[model samples]
Each structure stands twice: as structure tokens, then as C-alpha cells.
Target: MLRWLRQLFNTSPLEFDESWRPELVSGFQHWSLLSQAELDRMEMLVTRFMATIDWEAANGFELTEQIKVLIAAQASMLLLGLDLDGYDDVTSVIVHPANVRLRGNRPSGGGTFSSAPIVISGQAHYQGPVLLSWAAARRGARFPEHGHNVVYHEFAHRLDMLDGVTDGTPPLEDAAAMARWTAVCTAAYDEVRAQGSPVLRPYAGTNPAEFFAVATEVFFNQPHELCEHEPALYGELRSFYGQDPAARISRPRRHHQHG
Candidate 1:
């Protein structure tokens, strides 16, 4: 009864404008892969996401509706199969026009930390905002073959931090699932660190948290490659995300000729 009342009283999702669909489709390459039904759901999710989050622009960059929609669409894709609030901890999204350089402490050979300026494309803060480079995000959306998506990578980190832990594992069904996730992720992570994986990038080997984020980028962008190289890891992600991108992607057919 209370749940029903809450549903009735809660603010409805913003009405998504169909006119914007063309712009979104042109901006994001993956949009063509989604079915009509999936596109409808994504529109709703993106509307909700854009309405819920606070947006800001840095480095004198202009924040436009198109930028917000594109980012929201990519971020919402992660939550499509899950039954949770859309990035509850992500209160703000700070976007830069391009790569931002920041001074950070780096570990030296010894136990000392050195301060240096590091360039970053995107960053997800625990219990804070998501920082992104607009250029990188746009490029990533257009080119999935590159196996890099700033929006997916940073949002994946936010998902990893949902359980108050950033150890690469998100909230799961039970202990058994957690164990399996840990085992498979650990093995793949080790492979990336030791001999480099064909599917995952070298940056994924930085840490367990990064592994999860980078793996997510590859999972969504290059599903066929991920499934082929890291079947166990792909299975874990598929089970968790409840989406089969591999099946959705249609491969090109070769023509046979007879003389």
C-alpha cells in the first residue's frame, strides 16, 4: 500500500523529446545497435538521469543539452538492467572541454610520494562528483572500436563504489556470486598485470577497482572481443548486468560466388 502510494506520488520521469533522438543517434554510434524498444527505455532513463543530476562546466566550457543527453545516455546504460536508483551518490557532473591536468602525489621508488601534474580524461569520486572531458567523451561515443568510453569507465567506478567499497566488486546477489566475481576478476586482473590481456587494456591492471572499470568499457564497447578472450570475465559481467551485448551486435556477412 505504501509502495503504491509512493509510486503514485513520486515525481514522474521527464518526457523525452523524440526530436532529440536523431541528434543522439548521430552523436552516439552505439545508438544504432539498440532496438526500438531498447531505445525507448534508454530515452526514459536518460531523461531521468539528466533531471536528477547537477551539471557543471569547467575551463570555460559551455554545457549544452546535447552534451548532457549524450553523457546521461551512456551512464544510464549501466543501470538499464539493474533495479537501483541512478547513481545516488553522484550529485554533480563536472565536464571539461578537454583533458584536465591536475597535480597529484605519485609514489616514487621508495616510500616517498612525489607531486606531479597528471593529465586525466575522467575521474569518479567516491561519494562525490564525476569529472569528465567532453572531447574524450564525444570521441568515445563515436568510436566504440577503440575500446574506450570515458562515461562508461567513470560510471563503472561509481557502481563499484556503491557498496562503500571500491575493490572492483559491486553489490551482488549473495556470497557465492561475490566469490565467483572475485575469483574470475582476480584471475583476469593477474593476466593483465603479468602478460597483458587481449581484451582488457594494460591500465586495468593498475588495481582491482580500475580493472572493473576498464573491463566495463571493453564489455560494452567490444563485446565480441571480450567474449572471445575472457569468457569467464564476460560471463560474470553478463550475469551481473543482465544484458547480452554480444547477441545484440550483428556481424557482417560474407558473400559466396559460384562460377
Candidate 2:
């Protein structure tokens, strides 16, 4: 079905519905932070993402336009500075009513795996679908200051997987940039694993893959805090993502004061 849809969409592109603007405004906190040009691009990306991906609802959950728009908007935020091809590995999006539970062997640090039942808000697979919880997605989109966005986290994993490796380092522009990213991220990862980070949560220490995702959340959601705590790490992310969310987030406030 997805392949067929993709083929069909190839013939004619999906149109962005102007009506979804309200959903974007209400469902996503970052909506207001975007410049006019960025908002236009975001709408285009959101329409492409929603139309191309095969969406599914689990646990008898009913999917709605609001939910889809909310999720797509957040996912598109990551690509606001990059090309849409960053998420090419993501073929589908499966949304559950709440956290997903599965009993299996999972990563538990120390290069070891633990066989236990774990519940997660979201999961990203290699060359596969992205699974998310609608409840968590809604909360994250509406409350980005919490610095945890499942859509950002999972889609970030997809971005990291674009280079065919999920070692936390996404495709860099050159060897020089790659070396810098390695140095900065490695130092931060070591700190998180040993002493811990105030901006990054404990889960980031689980692995480099997770460290990237959690850092992505902080980079966008809590840009100022992350920038203040880890300037080099934040610089690496800003350079890689081609976005300075701290400035975008602060521009509005500076305007309101004079207005």
C-alpha cells in the first residue's frame, strides 16, 4: 500500500492544506518561533512527510488530522534547515495510544543487553518504521520546554542512520567537520557517562546513538540551556543542523519588548 501510494504521489505532489495552520499553531509550540520564510518551508515539508509516509494506529487508536499534523510538524522541524532527504530511511510512522510495551532483550549500557519488559514513548528502527506514542507526541509538541520530543528524538535517529550507521555522528560536510564532531561529542558523551550533564538527561549516557537523540531534543527545545551548559557541543549541533534555534526562539521576545 505504501509503495503504491509513493508511486501515486510521484505523479502528483500532495497539497498543503491551509486549514492545518490552526493545528500547527495550537499543537506545536515552536510554530510561532519560525520566520515567515521558515514557516513556508515547514508547511511544504509537513505536507510531503504526511503524504509520503504510511501512517498506522496501534492499540485501537484512532488517528486524526490534528495528530498527524502535530507529529509531521515536529518531524519537519528537524529538517527545517536540511533537505527533506534526511528522513528517507523512514518509510512509515506507527502511532500508539500510549507508551509501547514489549518484553525482549534491550540495551542496558556496558555493551550488554537485558531481557526485560520495557515501555518506551518512541522507537526508531534501521531502514524501518518509526513508532511513537500519540500521548507523548502531543505532550512533547505542546511542551517543548520540557526538552524531550519523541518525534525529534526518533527522527534524529533516522537522520543519524542516513550514513548507514547510528553511532550518533550524522553525515558531516567534510573530514575536518567530522573530526570536530567526534571530538566534541565524544567529550560530552564521556562527561554524561561519568559525571553527568545538567542539560542532557541520564538516558543520553546509554549510548552514543541515544546521546545524539537526547542532544537533538535539547538543541531544539532548550537551546539556550544547552548552549549555556555545553557551548562546543551546541556549536557542533548548530553547525550540523544548520539552525540556531536559540536565536529563532529569542527573536520574538526581543520584538515584543519594543512592540
Candidate 3:
């Protein structure tokens, strides 16, 4: 009916260019970690993301296809296992050449707020466009060791806001799952604030939303460290993300000589 008609008139399905695979592999470290099948699926998702969203460049920055592909790849990684539509509220992606300085109010002590400018790498607004710094996004994609991915961090926020709430919790399966998620996340969040955690960085202690975002970066980037240090938290992330990055990542074994 109408669906069929729309499909008939719509353009052909978007496909990732084979030539771009090399660039993607060289730029994104996590790209090499994915299997062939996962790469295929990722390519499709990236294509859909690129086609659906309106890409914009800020401050006289030119929006290149490579940039679009790289950003879309990272953002699509978050939705690999989820079933919801890809950022339905996000209509545009605004990319800046470098870090953006935003004018806002900051606490100046003595229970006073003062006007100031804050430099940020990325930001995701509810029911609005996502803002990103191209330099930070590219660097984060290349170096997973940093555990600071602007694309993952902002897209994670978008996922958290899917249910009209900015809380750390996203849509869960059932009451039991929700209960477990809340318990594990609450305990971990408290621990992050109280004494700090080795696996999770200090930024996670900022808030529940930030905790989810920062945890996601570690979950995907530093999976081995996260699994070793925070097994429970890692388990929850694995259950929710439906992916075991630690298993996907290939590590060499050291042979010990007999004493």
C-alpha cells in the first residue's frame, strides 16, 4: 500500500563504497576489531545514517564524505544491537572545525552563578541537532586508548533521551532487567562518586547520564580493562549492548618457560 509506494519511489538502498574500507580501517581502530559480517552490517547502518540525517558544517568548515562516513560509523556502532529507530529526533549534525566555546552560566562559589564560556567537544540536545568538534571526533575514533569518544558520548546521550527522560537508564526489556540495571548502575554510580573507579574515569562521576556515556566509551574501547576491573558493570553493559567487545578483540598470549 502506502509503504510499498514509498519504497517504489524512494532512491535505491545506500551502500558503502568498498574503497572507503581502507580509510575507515586506518582511521578507526575499532573498525578492524569487527568481523566481516559485523562490518557489513555496520556499513549498511552507516549508509542509512548518512542518508537520513542532514549534515551541516560550521565556521566555514567543509563537510567531506570521509568525515561523514567516519562520524556515522561511530554513531551507528551504538545502535548495532538496539531495535529502536536511529535517533528519530535528530534531524541535523553540525560539525565544527575544533572545540566549541559556549557561553553559559557557571557556579562562581558562595552559591552564586556567573556568566562564562565553556569549551566542549560535543553536545546532544533533546529533539534537536547534535553538535560535534571534528578534531575531537576524529582523534577519539583513531585512539581508543583515550576513552573519550565525542561521537559515542553524544550519541549515548541521544539513546538515553529516547524515552523522554535524560536519566542514565534507557529502555529495558522487563521489570527484572530494569531492577537489575538500576541496582548495578546505582551502586556503580555511587562508587564512582565516593572513591572513584580504576576502569571508569572521573567524568563518569559527573552525573548519571555522564556515567552511562563514559561507561559506554570504556565498554567499547577498553573492554579488557573494564571486564577485568568491573565485571558486574561490564556484564550489565554486555547484556544491554548485546555485544562482547572483550571477546571480539584479539589479544596475543604470552608463553611462559618452564622453571
Candidate 4:
């Protein structure tokens, strides 16, 4: 069905074209999470974002361009530093107006000090499928002077799983980089759990998975603060992502906030 839709879209002349795409990708109303370069990367990630998503008009939900920008921005931000190579692993994203219902009696990490089981709000499986709620996605993108990005949170799982395990470690640039990332992230995560104040967000301490996602949010939306407060983590991230977003956020914006 997706291939059919792609062929049909390619055959159509009335849909969005690539020439004017970069101009429309922004989340000015609720997101200050992307740089012009980052946004352009998003344009590259999803100029055909709509093309890849299983676009549909569902009842009780209004999927707006703003929403598309929000999701694409978050997803693109994930790969702003490294080459986003494994995205074809998940060819479709299923979105609902709100959290979708996981199947009944689904257990979460059963037994061995993890037997508290129940359905989760959002899940990205190892089989290359992503699921999200429109409301969850919107709330996540609001950047409410807090940290928590649902899109990045779930998609981080996807990227981490590409190596055949969801252990919260994505493929790094080199072995040396991987060793350094683990060491630095572990130290930072432990520090945050021990004495670091909750400046970035609390979920960063939930686990390595949450740490990557939360780090991503702060890396983009609150770069200056992250840089100032968690210099080691910031430096490690600078090395990891290859993009200094804190530097980008510090520069002047050529465009004014129209709203």
C-alpha cells in the first residue's frame, strides 16, 4: 500500500514540490529546537516526510503542517550529528489523535525485578514500526520550558535498536567514539542521578534510552543552559552529534518571530 501511494504521489503533479520545501519547515510557535541548518536537515529528512508517513485523514484528529513540522523536526534532530542511515528500517509512522491502545494483557519486562507489567502509551518495536499519538507528539513539541520529547524519546529507541538490541546505544562514528560516549554518558548520568540539579529534565535519569532522548531535547531547545551546566555532557554531545547546536542557538536569527 505504501509503495502504491508513493507511485501515485510521484505520478501526481499537484502535490508539494522540492523547490519551495525548505521554507515551510519550522516550529516557531512551540519549538525553538532547530537551527536553519537543522531545519534544512529536517527538510532533507522529510521534504518527503509526508511521502513516507502513512498519511491519512482520521476522525477526531487534525494533523496540521505544524504537527508535521514538529514530528519531522524532532525526528531529524535525532540524526543532526551523525548520518541517519537506518531510517529505512521503519518505513511507516502510525499516528493517532491521542495515545493508541496497546493490545490487551501486554506485559512489560516481566519478572526478574521488572514484573510490573502493563500496556505502554507509545512503543517502537524491533521490527521497524513507529507509533505515536498526535496529542502526545504535540505536547512533546511544545517545549514548555521543560524537557521531554515524545518523538525523540520513542525514535531514540528505534535508532538504538538498529544494532539488533535496544540497549540505548546507537551506532557511533568509531570505536574510540563509542568508548568515549559510553564513559562520558555514564559519568554524566550518574552525576545527574547523584548531585546534578534537574535543569535539563528528570527523565534523563530513567535509563540510557531516556538519557539519549532527553539529551537530544536539551541539545536542541536549551543548548546554552546545557552547555553552561553540564559542560562534560555538552562536550561529549558535541563530539557525538557533530553539530554544536548551542552555538547555533547563540547566533542571531535573521528572521523575526512573526507571531
lDDT per prediction? 0.85, 0.87, 0.84, 0.63
Alpha carbon lDDT of residue 178, candidate 1? 94
Name the top lDDT candidate: 2
Candidate 2, which ten residues in sequence have the lowest lDDT sum?
Answer: 250-259
lDDT by residue (16-133, candidate 1, tens digit) is 8776687788999888888888777787788777767879899789999889888988998888778864776786899999999988787643478879788999999998889999
**Best-to-worst ranking by TM-score:** 2, 1, 3, 4
Better of 2 and 3 by lDDT: 2
Better of 3 and 4 by TM-score: 3
**What are the per-residue Cα lDDT tens digits for candidate 3 across 49-126?**
776777899999999989998998999999887774366578689999999998878765568897888889999999
Q: Give candidate 3's error at residue 175 in angstroms.
A: 1.0
Candidate 3, RMSD to the unseen true structure: 5.7
TM-score of 1: 0.90
In candidate 2, which residue pairs get closer than 3 Å at backbone N, Cα or C atoms, i.e. clash?
A: none
Model 3 whole-model lDDT (C-alpha atoms): 0.84
In model 1, where do residues sit more than 4 Å from their true spots? 1-10, 104-112, 252-259
Q: How well does each candidate superpose onto the true structure, as a TM-score?
A: 0.90, 0.92, 0.89, 0.73
RMSD of each: 6.1, 4.5, 5.7, 6.0
Question: Between the candidate structures 1 and 4, which one is better when assessed by TM-score?
Answer: 1
Clash count, predicted structure 1:
0
lDDT string, candidate 2, 21-84, tens digits: 9988988999998999998888888888877788899988999988999999999999988855
The 10-residue segment of model 4 with minimum total lDDT is: 250-259
